[model samples]
Target: MTQTATRDDDVAAGPRASAERQGDVRLSLQGVDAFYGQIQALRGVSLEVRQGEIVTLLGSNGAGKSTTLKTISGLVRARQGDVCLEGESIARLPAHQIARRGVVHVPEGRRVLRGLTVKENLELGAFTLKDNALRRQRLEEVYALFPILHERRHQDGSLLSGGQQQMLAMGRALMHGPNVMLLDEPSMGLAPKLVTEIMRIIKRLNEAGTTILLVEQNARLALRLAHYAYVIENGEIRMQGDAAAMREDASVVKAYLGLGD
Candidate 1:
């Protein structure tokens, strides 16, 4: 059987889709089908992110990477299947509600509000919060995570460098105290150094207790950082395995990891 039809028996597949594994699944997408005006973007995609794991979804552009994150965050409706968070169904919930429930989607583009100051943009992230004190506390936490944000807190978000803007985007998402973060193409358009920096920050975030579902086109980076990975093609899952194993596969090397001759 294909790995998608069942778990990878050779290596531990973490807790996301494993019924026999311990602890709770932070996010579960089962047979999830998403459509854009009748154009089916996802073909029964199923995956799992266990509590405190970094799972990556790897695919080329237009391969339903962003759509999958959008579906989980409720920006797009699922035409079929179920999305459960800690065992509760959220497939049909609205985007805002999904975010409030601790599922935050940091979209591909660094969509920071250009007109807003760094602090203002981060404040917008806590829109679900009513307590000013708690919001302030969360904002401080985000600033600590991305210290450059604190350095530019008074400047307009657009005035920051690309890497700083990306930091602001992540800081904004952090304000929501997200249990699970759906990050799309975080390494896009960044310098090689900046990409390494951002990936390091992502690893730190997961180490600090946030489950991550990463959508990335950088096959080498994704395979290096992900504990487990799912490869999708034309809206369907094509392969899956332990991230390290996938990295070593001959087909994966030729097709995705840029090691092909």
Candidate 2:
């Protein structure tokens, strides 16, 4: 059975109804398989991320969480099945082409341009735009979202703290005005306080109507912020459900999330 698209009305109702609506998926993978040379990284993985929601990919290291994002973004092509964006197939599209269709990926590491000034780094995000006016407008919007970036506009990205770098990474992605933001480990390598701050920024972004697909090691934090989540194991989805329920699952609590039993 195909999954359903989740609407704003469904979320306020409850989790079960939300899951049912999500079962009618928006961005869907139907038996997707991917490989790197002879080693298979993904094995018939199927999942969904509805529009206007934060869906998290939760799992241990090497569980193909990163690979899933790459495949969806067209950085890695699928060997089998299909990847659809709003019911249109993008499996054959290149990474840049997919990104042009409003799928922006922040990647695993905070890959900010180390030597570039914050303003320069953000300018790079508008490289595909032909309209100078539009680029400037978007840049101003990004600065508004992240005032820190504007404060350090002339400072080199390398000089910023880890939290600040993550913000810059996200700010760069926002320059394109994406419909879906694929964030890989946004909380990685930050102090606890900074992590909370970053997650709050993500929440605020979602509240302002940006859809997010977050891949994070901090399960507790991710689940709390996400609408739905998938638990990946050995390159496949082992469990999928509402985020809050997954957070309470005993196995998930003990194994991947490091929560008490």
Candidate 3:
């Protein structure tokens, strides 16, 4: 089912945190309009993320969440408006160019290469990098964050379980040390423990200065992990506010929290 968009559990996102101090704008989506052929998917959508903050987009499936990420990543072109990173326009750049600029996208379904080994898959993420030392540093850092990947570094990524493959996809993205990571459904199809683990890792990434633009189906989890959030419906933003404020909103409970009567 397409999720009902809402926001809840906005207690500073992860455990032991308070209101976050938003910093310099790291990524900006300004008056974006997108389409799939003749069909419009995003209508003047705009949002911003600053350094070291988790900004989430909450919405039902087909509400343009994934499309938004695709636009930022340059997988899909923006027909109108501009996408800027660190104040430079990139709305018309190709996908590889966007990745080179440190806007990494971890798309849904853990799109890892099935035939490639875990290490090989990670190496692909650094295709833009020419420096061998930087690649080695990122590889070691990814291994440090996900020790399971280190243990199975030689195994084909397809051989790993769902949770492990998710880690691999994330690790591969980190090989570029992205400034703004566009994550789509990071917690989908995982057990409760795995979900918690992934969320914790996401929080850690944000803490380490990677600005995040997350699109999630799990509203409560999304709010619990984000500092600010926007709600989208029918390809338009319906609401936006601080995560703490969204948690207690009556509209969120009824639509997304499944408290509808």
Candidate 4:
């Protein structure tokens, strides 16, 4: 379910308020190609996320959405391509080095550490920070963003509900004071109410000026929330457009948005 690739407008005139936040390019991937053993996972994939904008990558399962995120975060190497952060090439950097550069990846399935207390899991995210005062300040900020986590600070992260775990995952990422957040399926497997809550938090994060690259299967929601979007299939970018145009695209509505089924 891919439409012909379209260019993303410099300014997204979408209904989302974040359109006004779009600024200089914060992250860019140029002609990226990746492989897992003998299997190719990404084929000349290219995309860019602007400062203070929420850009969504849409695809079904195994469409390389997660792989794309991994590549940006340096968890998966780009076999042939340029992954740049603010005009500097980071393609060859190690995962930790990339993290130090402010690219945070909140992986799918809410990978919260089961044995660690909720607070402990969050503190681990600030490992790179050397200043205790800054770390404490960041911790307070995360707690404020998620009061439930503060309430459950003593409890193991895995003991929390699905939504709570998702909060914990996001809280952990926020601790790093990330420049760009690559969120993979933040809404997966949550109840409808919880989904709405998570989406609201994501919106809040963006409004507070965190650049985001969101990979979501919920096309209707993604299109509604994002400033811009890219659709990929079989490891190739098949479509790209501002969210407003994408929501109105007939092929996109039928395929990802579940219309005309």
Which regions of candidate 4 are displaced past 4 Å? Answer: 1-21, 255-261
lDDT for model 4, on a 0 to 1 scale?
0.86
Superposed model 3: Cα runs more than 4 Å off: 1-12, 15-21, 256-261
User: How many backbone clashes does every candidate have?
Assistant: 0, 7, 1, 0
RMSD of 4: 5.2
Candidate 1 residue pairs in backbone clash: none
lDDT of 1 by residue, 134-180 (tens): 99999889888898899889999998888888899899999988999
lDDT by residue (1-261, candidate 3, tens digit) is 333233233223543224554588899999999999999999999888877788889877788899999999998889998999999999988888889889999999999898999999999999878999999999999999999999999999999988898899999999987988999998788876677778789889888877899987777777778888888878788777787667667687568545443
- Backbone clashes counted, model 2: 7
Model 4 over residues 71-115: C-alpha lDDT tens digits? 998888999989999999999999999999999999999899989
Which candidate gets the maximum lDDT versus the true structure?
4
**Alpha-carbon local distance difference test for all models:** 0.81, 0.82, 0.84, 0.86
| CA lDDT, candidate 1, residue 148 | 89
- How does each model score on TM-score? 0.89, 0.89, 0.91, 0.91
What is the per-residue lDDT of model 2 for residues 1-261, given as tens digits with 9 covering 90 to 100? Answer: 111122222222112325464433557788999999999999999988887688889887888999999999998999999999889999999999999998999998888887899999998887899999999999998888899999999999878998999999999999988888999998788877677677778888887878889998777667777888888888888888888777667787677544553
